[model samples]
Structures are given as structure tokens and as C-alpha cells.
Target: MRFRKRVLLYLVPAFVIYSAFMLIPLLMSMRVALYEYTGIGDMTFIGLDNFQRLLFESPYADRFINAITNTLEFFLYTMVFQNVTALLLALALTRGLKLTGLFRTIIFIPVTISILMIGFIWTLILNPNIGVLNQFLEVIGLEAWATAWLGNEATALPTVAVVNAWQYTGLMVMLFIAGIQSIPEDRFEAARLDGAKGWNIFRHIIFPAIIPIVGIVTIMTLMGVFNQFDLIYAMVGSTGGPNYAVDLLGTLFYRTAFGGVGGQVPQMGLGAAIATMTFFYDLYVCHRHALY
Candidate 1:
């Protein structure tokens, strides 16, 4: 009873802090979503009007939808790219090769850098004028591939997703390595005895064993993608560049709720609405994952 009381005392303050900072704000944001704010006087209590306007009436509604779609696309691509690259890298590096430690260090080094710095580095690499990527393409007689990657409407989001994958794949690789290592060697030996080899062993034994890790990584990647704002903001400025091609919920909420380059007045209520929607979407995804 004494130990229990002590643990409760320790947990109480953390719970209070979490409730104050996170739970309270979340509830308040959900409340804001049900209102309409005209940016002048009292916020009118028009329940669900904000959601309707965002989904139906607003001029920027298409942009909002596009941002959501872009976010999903980015998440999907990054999930596949990161997981596949990480798994393959793990498999290759686990073969008891020389310089394995050095290779792992090199791979994970970029994962330690900030996403903003990673964005800036990729920006330089993919810059149309005097960028190394473009120069290499030109040298290889692939000048057509040298177009402005981040500035092109068709390629901006994809370019950013690829850059994100490049930065985080190393971490994913390390995680996959751990997961692979945790699989008992006796299982592999038994599989080998049963004629399982290469892709057969991977498909039957390795993949099933890693489902929990994959689910965890997927959830993390989903949340990261939905909230991704800094890298896009840094690379293409607040506009999300090349005609808002790289926009996502985070950027939309910021621009709508807090004003952007055009000096739009802050509409805290609308911002709250956007945030609530994003929160619910993330929740739904997470719940679905849990169900699965």
C-alpha cells in the first residue's frame, strides 16, 4: 500500500500536466470545430458549420482536400520505400560482411540530422541551376531529368517524399535489423532443413515474424506524414510551392489559423477546426491499424 501510494503520487503530476497541455487543448479544438468565427466579434455557435465550409463552401476547400490527399500519398510512398529499403539493407548487412559497423554508421548518420537540414541538403542537390543532381543528369545525357524537382507541380510532393525516405530509411533499417536479429537462428536452420531458402524463407518466416514491427513503423510513418510541415515549408516556402503541390494538413492549419506570407488574419477557430479534423483522421487511421 505504501509503494502503491508512492507510485500514484509520482504519476499524478505527470497526468495533471498531460491533461492540462494535451487533453484540454484537444477537447477545446474539437469544440472549436463546431463553431463559426467571422474574425470580428463574438464567435457564433454554428455547430458543424466550420466543417461544412471547409468541406463544401470555402474557396480554399480544394486546396485543403489536395493537401490531405498529398499527405496520404506521401505516407503511402514513404511507407513502402522506407520499409522495403530498410528490410533489404538489413538483409544485406546481416550477411556478416566486412566493414559492417562502418556501413551501419554511415547509413544512420543522416537519420540524426534535422528534417529541415535534410530538406535544405536535398534542395541543393536537386536545384535546377547548378545542382549536382541536374549536373549529373546532364553529364549522363539525361538532361530531361534535370528539371526543377521541388518547383514542379507534378513532382514536388513526390520529390519531398523521396527525400524524407532517404533521410529516415537508415533508422528503419536499424529497426528492421533488430527485428531480424530477434528471430531465433534455430528457426532459420529448421527452415533450411525443410528446403526453405532465400525469398522462400523471407516470405514465410521473416515477414510473419516482423508484422508487429511493420505495424508500429507504419503508425509512426503515418503520424509523421500527416504532421509533416517543416521540410515542405523550408523547401518551397509557405506556399507549398509550384502551386501548392506539396501542401499537407500541418501547413494548411498554419496558413489558415496563423497567417502566412499574404498576411491573412489569424482565425483561431478555423485553425482549431483544421487541427481537429487532422486529429480525427489520425485517430481513425490508428484505430483501424489497431483493429487490424
Candidate 2:
């Protein structure tokens, strides 16, 4: 009874904090979206006009579609590349090889750095004129292959996607490594005794045990990638430049609420609408993924 009370005591404050900070704000934002806000005067009661405008209006409608598409594209690219690369790294590192610890550290190094710093470093690396990447390509007599990576509309989004994948793959590798390391050594010994080695052992025992961990990693990566804004914002600028080819929902929401220049007076109602839509979309995605 005392232990239960102690646990409840700790949980109470945590719950209160979450409710006050996250839950309340989310509810308030939804409420704000349902109402219409003007700069100075009282807010009017407009049920779904904001959403209709966001969906059916001229400029806003296009922006909304672009934002949704860009965000989804970014999320998809991150999940596919990051997980595959991380899994490959985990497989290689988990083998009882020399210098495993050093390799693990090297893989996880990027995850330790700030995303903003990573963005800046990648931007310089992908620079068209003075960047080492282009310089190396030119030296290799493949100058045509050395076009501006972040500047090209065709490659900009994918370029950012690769950078994001590179940065987070290390963290996923570490997670998989932890999961792999937790498997019982006796299981391996038994498999070896049963003439089960190499891919056979992995396919049977190691793989199954890691599925749950991978599922967790997948959900986390999905959310992180879906909501990603900082790296793209930093590397490509907030507008997701090159004619907004990289314009993600997060960036769109920012630009919409707080107009780009001259503090053109924020449209809290529209911003709230975008945010509310994003919130629901995220909820649906999370729920769908959580089921598996």
C-alpha cells in the first residue's frame, strides 16, 4: 500500500505537468481553430470556414496541398532510408569483430551533434562552387555530376532527406545494437549446436526478438520524420527554397501564421487551422502505426 502510494505520488505530478502543458494547449488550440480571430477586435464564431478556406480557397489551398505533400514525402524518405541503413549497420556491428566499440561510437557521433549544426555542415559540403564534394567530383573528371546539390530543384528535397537519414541512422543503429545485445548467448550456443549458424540463427531467434524493438523504432522514426522541420529549415532556409519545392507542413504553418516579412500581422485563425489539421493527421498516423 505504501509503495503504491509512493508510485501514485510521483505519477500525479507528472500527469499534472503533461495535462497543463500539452493537453490544455492542444485543447485550446483546437478551440481557437474553431473560432475566427481578427487582429484587434473580438473573435467571431466561425465553425469550419477556416478549414474550408484552407482547402478550397485560391492561394491558401495550393499552399496547404504543397505543405501536406512535402511533409509526407520527407517522412517517407527518412523512414525508408534511415531504417535500412541503421539495420545494415546494426548487423555489421553486432558481429563479434574487432574495434566494434570504435565503430559504434563513429556511427552514433552524428546523433550527438545538434541538427542545426549538421544542417550547416551538410550545406557547406553540398555547396556548388567551393564545396569539397563538388571539388572532388571535378577532380574525378565528373564535373557535370557536381551541380548544386541543395540548390537544384530536382535534387534538393532528396538531398535533405539523405542528410536527415545520415544523421539519425546512427541512433537507430545504437537502438538495434542494444536490442541485439540483450538476446541470450545460450540461444546462439543452442542454435550453433543444432547446425544453425549465420543467417539461420538470425532469421530464427535474433530477428524475432528484435521485431518489437524495430516496431518501436519505426513509430519513433515516423513521428520524428513527420514532424521534422529544423534540419530542412536550416539547410534550405525556412521557405524551403528553390520555389518552395521543399516546403514542409511545419514551415508552411510558420509562414502562414507569422507572415514572412514586415511582421505582416499573424493569422492566428489560419495557423490554428493548419496546426489542428496536422495534429489530427499525426494522431491518425500514430494510431495506425501503433496497431502493428
Candidate 3:
């Protein structure tokens, strides 16, 4: 009883902070979604009307759908590019190569930098007219392949996705490395003794041992992708330019709630509705993952 009491006491501060920040704000947003508010004057209660408008109305529905599609694409890109690359890099780093520490530091450097700064830097690099990337392409006789990466609708979202993947890949690599290192050395020794090499060792030992870490990385990626805003905003602006090709739920909610985009009247209730839906969807995904 005393030990349980001590544990509960230790948890109280964290639980309080979490409730004060996360839980309260989430409940308030859900409540706000059931009303009509414009960030000023009076708020009118309008049970589920905002959700109805968001789902079935004209412009709102279209933009919401677009944001959902883009967010999913962003998550998919991160899973494929970021997680895969991290896994590969982690595998390589675990091979006891020389200067592994230096390589790990280089990979993780980008994660320590500001997302906005990274966005600005990449924007300069991807610029069509004067960017280093285009200049390099020209030098290599591939000038025809160089184009307006951030300005073209076809490439804008994918380009931003790649940038995001680059910024966070290091963190994923570290997680994977930790997972790989946690595997018993005896397992690898046994595998080698059994004539297992390279792919077989990884398939039979590393991969199975790190399944939990993979799940953790996937959940983190999913949450991060849904909450992605700053990098996209810094790279493409609040309107998610190139005709909103790069817009995600986070950008959509911010623009609607705060009127960050030109000529957009702030719709606090509708923004809250968007947020509420996203929160629930994320919750559902997390719950499903937990069940599995």
C-alpha cells in the first residue's frame, strides 16, 4: 500500500500537467466545435453544424478532403523514405565501421536545427532560377530535368515531404540503432556460426527483434505528419501555395482559425471542428495500433 501510494504521488505532477495542457485544450476544442464562433463577440451554440458544413459543404468539404489526402501522402512518404532510410543507415552503423560516431553526428545535425531555418535553407536550394540544385543539374548537363520544385503542384508536396523526411530521419535512425543494439550479441554470434550472413542475419535476428521499435517509429511518424505545419508554412506559406497542393490538416486548421491567409475570415468554430476530427482520427489509429 505504501509503495502504491508513493508511485501515485510521483505520477500526480505529470498527470496534472498533462490534463492542464493536453486534455483540457482537447475538450475545449471539442466543445468549441459545437458552436459558431469567429474569435470575437458572441459565440452561438450550433450542435454539429460545423462538422456538417465541413463534411458536406462546398469549399470547406473540398479543402478538408484535400488536406486529408495531402496529410496521408505526407505520412506515406515519411514511412517509405524516412523510416526505410533510417533502418538501412542504422544497420550500416551497427557494423562496427570506422568513424561511425562522426557519421551519426552528421546525420543527427539536421534534427537539432530549427525546422523553419531548414525550410528556408531548402527553399533557397530548390529555387528554380538561382538554386544550387538547378545549377548543379545544369553543370551536369541535366538542366532539362531541373524545374521549379516548390512552385510546381506536381512536385510541391513531395518536395516538402522529402525535406521533412530529411530533417527527421536522423531521429528515426537513432531509435533504430538503439533497437538493433538491444539485441543479444549471442544471437548474432549464433547466426554467424550457422553460416548466416547479411540479409539472413537481419531477417532472422535484427528485424524480428526490433518489431516493437518499428511500431513506435510508425506511430511517431503518423502523429508528426498529422501535426506538420511549420515546415510547410515556412516553405510554401500559409495558403499552402502551388494551388494548395501542399496543404495538410495543421495548415488548414491554422488558416481557418487565425485567418493567416489573405482574405480569409477567421472561423474558430470550423477550425475547432477540423481539429476535433483530426484528434479523433489519430486516437482511433493509435487505439487500433495498440490492439494489434
Candidate 4:
């Protein structure tokens, strides 16, 4: 009885808080998916019609497909640009370089600011007219290489992806640095005594030890890329402009739910359906990745 009370003492408050904040709202969203209701009156109990339309009908279908396609592409881009680059930077920094603290601080400064702020800052830097990047290119006699980065269809999606990667790479770097630092020093000494050197040492010792961190970083990056919205909205608005080139599921949800685009009438039920799928999708992906 005493042990039960002690367990309940610590667990009850956390359970109550989670139920109020997360579980309740999640249930509400699922319930909302079954009915057609705006923020106004006269909600129609549409059952599965909204979901059918969203999955197989007209405008929603195409946009959902496009958003999903772009989401996957965004993940791929970030995996290469963000995680790989962070690992490289972490490796280099871990090698005991001069001014290591200064460089690490400079790299991590981006992570300290809000994503909204980073988006705005990069928007200004990458602006075609009177932008610093273009001005620098022109000054260096590379004006011919300069183009409208976020404004051009060919470059827009990739540019936005890269910008996100740039902002979050610092976080990945820090995670990797922590992983590297946690490794036992005796392992390195043992490897050296065994006449192992350079790539051989890292291949056998460092990389194997950091596998858990790699999996963690991978899943975190996946979630961030999948749930991306604010940066794209801040940099280019929710339209996912330049021919709807940078669209993702997060932006799609807003447009559908709030009537930001695609239709004059808000499709709250359909939006809820999408949100539900996203939740399940994230859960599944996280579960799979957590195995590593």
C-alpha cells in the first residue's frame, strides 16, 4: 500500500497533465474529423465523406500528393546536407583544433535563435534585389552565377530545404559532439596500441560507439522535416509559392483547415483527417527508428 502510494504520488500529476494537454486534444481532433464544422455553427455529421474526398476526390488529393512528395524530398535533402555535414563538422572539431570553442560557438549561434528568425534572416540574405549574397557574388566577379534563389521554381524548394538544414545542422553537431565525448578514452589508447591508425581507428571504435546517437539524430531530423511549417511560412508565406514548389504537409493542413488556399470554404473535417494521419505516421516512424 505504501509503495503504491509513493508511485501514485509521482505518477498522478504527470498523467493528469498529459491527459489534459495531449490526450484530450488528440481525441478532440479525431472526433472533429468525423464532423463537418467550421469555427461557426451548424456542424454536419459527415462521417467518412470528408476523408473519402480528401483521399480520392479533386483538389485535396492532388495537393496532398504533392505535399507528401515534397515532404519526402525535403527529408532526403536534409539527411544529406544537415546530418552528414554535422557529422563532418563534429569530427573535425573533435580533433583538438585551435580556437575550437570559438568555432563551435559560431556554428551553434544559429540554433540559439528562433526558426522564424532564421527564416526571416535567410530570406533577406537570399533576396534577389539588394541582397547580400547577390551583392557579394557581383563584387567577386561571379554575378553570372547569381539567380533569384527563393523566387525561382527550380531553386525554391531546394533553397528552402538547404536553409532549414543550415539552421538545424548546429543541433546535430552538438548531439554528435556529445556522443563522441562520452566515449571512453581507453578505447582510443587501446586502438593505438594495436597499431590501428586514422580511418581504421574511427571505423572500429568511434563510429560503432556513436550508433545510438546517429539513430536519435536521424529520427529527430525526420520529425523536424516532416513537421516543418513555420520556416516556409515565414520565408515565403503559406502559399508555398514559386509555383507551389515548396509545399509540405504542415502548410497543406493550414491551408485546408483555415481556408488559406485551395477553396473558399474551409474543410475542417478533411484537415482533421490529415492531421490524424500525420500523427499516426510520426508514431510509426519514431517507433521504427527507435529500434536503432
Candidate 5:
């Protein structure tokens, strides 16, 4: 009984914190999602009307659809360019690179920078008028390639997605590196003795060993990609400007909950509905993937 009491002392703080920060908010959001409530007005219990309107009857259906699709595109881009590239880098680093420590630090530096700062920095770099990128293009006689990266609807979403991928690639790199380091070196030696080289070694040995780590990385990337708001919010503002080119579900929730420059009146209920649905959708995707 004394030992159990001691164990409870250690667990109680964590339980309290989790309940206060995560569990409480999750329950509150689900409850709020069923009501018609603005920030100021009293809430009215409306059953699933908010969800019905959001999915089938909302005037902003088209925009919401676009946001959902854009978010998926962003996730795909990250999976391919960021996570895959990070895995490649980690693999390369394992091939007896000398300055491994320096390289790791340099790669991870961008992740240490604030998301807002990275957005502002990239904004300055990609500016059409006087940005360094355009100037560099002009100097190199590639002026035709220089364009307003964030302003043009065609390039805006992809550009922001790439920017976000760039910032987070280092995190995936570190994850991959850790997985690679934990691998048994004897396995590589055995493969080397069997004349397996290059892609064969990686495919047959290293790749198989890292499947569990890949699952973890995939789930984390899924969560981060789905919940992405900071970088887009910082770069494109709350409105997701230039014709909502880079709008995401996160931004949609924010815009709905709080009226923006060119948005509708506060629809806190609808915003909560979107939030609740998206949270579960992401959870379901991750859970389904994990189960398989």
C-alpha cells in the first residue's frame, strides 16, 4: 500500500497536467462543436446542424474543399521531399562522413529558428521586387524564372509547402539518424560479405530495420502536417491571401472562429465543428495506419 501511494505521487502531476491541458480542451471543443456560439453571444444547442452545414450546406463548401485538398498536397510533398530526403541524408551520413557533427548541427539549425522567423526570412528572400533570390536570378541571367512566389496563386501553395518541408526536414533527418545509429553494425558487415552493395545493402538491410521508426515518423508528420498553421499564418496572414491559395483546415478554423479582414462573421460553432472533425480524421488515419 505504501509503494502504491508513492507511485501515485509520481503519476498524479502528469495526470493533472494532461487532464488540464489536453483532455479538458478536447472535451470542451467537442461540446462546443454542437452549439451555435459566437465569442460574445450565448450558445444555442443545435445538435449536428453545424456539421451538416459545414459538409453539405455551407456557402464556403468550395473553399473548405480546397483547404482539405491543399493540406493533403502539403503532406504528400513533405513525405516525399522532406522525410525521404532526410532518410537519404541520414543514409549518406552513415557512410563514414568525417564532419558528421558539423553537418548534423547545420542541418538542424533551421528547426531551432522560430516558424514565424523562418516565414519572414523566406518572405524576404522570395520577394519579387527587391529580394535576394530575384536579384541572384537577375545576376545569373535567369531573370525569367524570378516571380512573385507568394502572390501568384499557381505557385503560392506549393511554395509554402516547400518552405515548411525545408524547415522540418532536419527533424526527420535526426529521427532517421537515430534509427540508423541504433541498427546493428554486424548486419551491414554480413551484407557486405555477401557482395550486397549500394542500393542492395540499403534496400535489403537498412530499410527493413527502420520500418518501426518510419511508422513513428509517418504518424508525427501526419499530425504536424494536418495541424500546420503557424508557418502559413505567419506568411499568408490569417486570411490565407492571394485567393486563398495556401489555405488549410487550421487556417479555416481560425478564420471561422474569428472574423478576418474579408471573412464572414464569427462562426465559432462551425469552427469547432471543423476542428473536431479534423482532429478525429487525423487520429483515425494514424490509428488505421498503425493497425496495419
Candidate 6:
């Protein structure tokens, strides 16, 4: 009993810090969502009016729905492109190829860089006129394939999603590589001895061994997608321009709580409500996954 008490005592400091930074602020945000505040005046007790306005009222409702749609679409894109690419790369790297360590280091370099810097660099690279991508296309006599990647509404969100995937895919690759390497070497030899090769070996041995890691990666990707802000903010402004094609929950919350490009009014109450909903949604997803 004394040992358990000492262990609990050691954890108290970290728990207090977490409560101070994360739990307390989350509760405050939920409380703020029940009031009407514009950052300057006194907060008025408005009950669930902010949430109602966000979900059922005009203009706000439209924007909320649009943000939800875009956020989900972004998640889908990352899940399909980012995670699959990581799994494939991890499988290849685990095969004892030459310069495997060098390849892994090179791939993970982007993950070590600042996300804001990644967004900024990609923005320049995707620029319509002077960007490397368009210039390369032109040099190869495929100029028609190049266009304003970030400026066009049809391509903005997907382009941002791709850039995000590119930046984070390396992290996922390292994770998958770890999972693959954890499998016993005897398992691979046995499969090979039984004439299993290529896809057969992966399906029977490697994939099953990495199932737990796959689940972890999926949950991490989901949480990361929902909480995404910095990359989008750096690449596109809080307005999520190009006709709001890339507007996400994070940008919506920022635009509401702190006003956008044009001198728009700050709706702190509505912003808090949006944030509260997003928080609950993420919590629910995590809870469901935990239960399963």
C-alpha cells in the first residue's frame, strides 16, 4: 500500500500540470460556449443558443456544415494516401535492402521539420507561375497539366491534404517499420520454407503481426486530422480561402472567435460552441475505439 501511494505521489505533479493546461481550459471553453461574448463586453448567459445558431440558424449553419464536410474529406484523403504509402514503404524497407538506414533517415527528415515551415515551403513549390512544380511541367512540355494548385477552388483542399500527407507520411512509416521488425525472424523463415513469397508472405505473416500498430496509426491519424490547424493556417489563412474550399473546424473556430480578413465581428460564444462540439466528437471517437 505504501509503494502504491508513493507511485501515486510521483504522478501527482504531472496530473496537476495536465489539469492546469488541458482539462481546465477545456472546461472553460465549454462554459464559454453557453454565453454570448465578443471578446470585449461582458459574457451574457445564452444557454444553448450558440449551439442552436451553429447547427440550425442561417449563415452559421452553412459554414459549420461546410467545415464539417471539408474536415471529413481531409481525413479520408490522409487515411487513404498517407497511411497506405507508409505501410508500403515500411514493407519495402524491412526487406533488408541496401542503404535501408539512409532511406529511412531521408524519409523521416520532413517529419522533423516544423509543420508551418513545411506548409510555407509547399506553398511556394505549388505556386502557379514561379513554382517548381509548374516550371517542371512546362519544361517537360506538359504545361497544360500545370495550373494554380492553391488558387483554384476545385483543387485547393485536395492539394492541402496531399501536402499534409506528404509531411506526416514519414512518421507513419517509422511506426510501421517498428511494428514489422517486432515480428519474430523465425516466422519469415518458416513462411519462406513453405514456399510463401511476396503477397502471400505479407498477407499471412507481416500484416497480421502489425495489426495492432495499424490500429494505433489509424486512431492517431483520426485524432490528428480532427485537430489539424497549423499546416492549414500556414498554407492558407484563417479564412481558408479560394471560396472557403479548404475551410475546416479549426479555421472555423479561429474565424469565429477572432474575426477574419475583412473586419468581421468576433463571435466568441459561437466559436466556443464549435470548439466544444469538435472536442466532444474527438472524445467520442477515441472512446469508441478504446471500447472496441
Model 4: lowest-lDDT 10 consecutive positions: 260-269
lDDT measured at residue 52 in model 5 versus the true structure, 0 to 100: 86
Please, what are the lDDT tens digits per residue for candidate 4 over residues 75-126? Answer: 9999998999999999999999999999999998888899889888899999
Candidate 1 per-residue lDDT, tens place, 1-292, comes to 9999999999999999999999998897788767666456777787877777788875767878988888888888897778788889999998789999999999999899987888788889998997899999999999887898987899888888888888889888888888888999999999999999999999998889988888888888989999888888878877777777888888888888777787788766777888988888889988998898
Deviation of model 2 at 16, angstroms? 2.9
Candidate 4 vs candidate 5: which has greater lDDT? 4
Order of the predicted models by TM-score, top scorer first: 6, 3, 4, 5, 1, 2
Q: Is candidate 1 or candidate 4 better by TM-score?
A: 4
lDDT tens string, model 5, 49-131? 98888778757677688789888888888888788899999998878889988998899999999999999999999999989
Instruction: Report lDDT (Cα) of residue 80, candidate 1.
Output: 76
Among the numbered candidates, top TM-score falls to 6
Model 6 per-residue lDDT tens digits across residues 1-292: 9999999999999999999999999999999999999999799999999999998999999999999999999989998889999999999999899999999999989988999899889999999978999999999999998999988998899899999899889999999999999999999899999999999999999899999899889999988988888998999889886888999999999999989888999999999999999999988988988886
Q: TM-scores for all candidates? A: 0.92, 0.89, 0.95, 0.94, 0.94, 0.96
User: Evaluated with lDDT, which candidate comes out highest?
Assistant: 3
Give the alpha carbon lDDT tens digit for every residue of 156-265 in model 2: 88889999999889889988989999999999999999999788988999889999888888788767866778988899877876888898888887777766654656
TM-score winner, 1 or 2: 1
lDDT of 2: 0.85
Which portions of model 2 miss their true places by more than 4 Å?
1-9, 38-41, 190-198, 261-265, 289-291
lDDT by candidate, in order shown: 0.85, 0.85, 0.94, 0.89, 0.88, 0.92
Q: Which regions of candidate 3 deviate over 4 angstroms? A: 1-13
Total backbone clashes of candidate 4, pairs 3 or more residues apart or in separate chains: 0
Instruction: Output the lDDT of residue 282, model 6.
Output: 88
Deviation (Å) of 20 in candidate 1: 2.4
Q: Against the true structure, what is every candidate's RMSD?
A: 2.0, 2.5, 1.5, 1.7, 1.7, 1.2
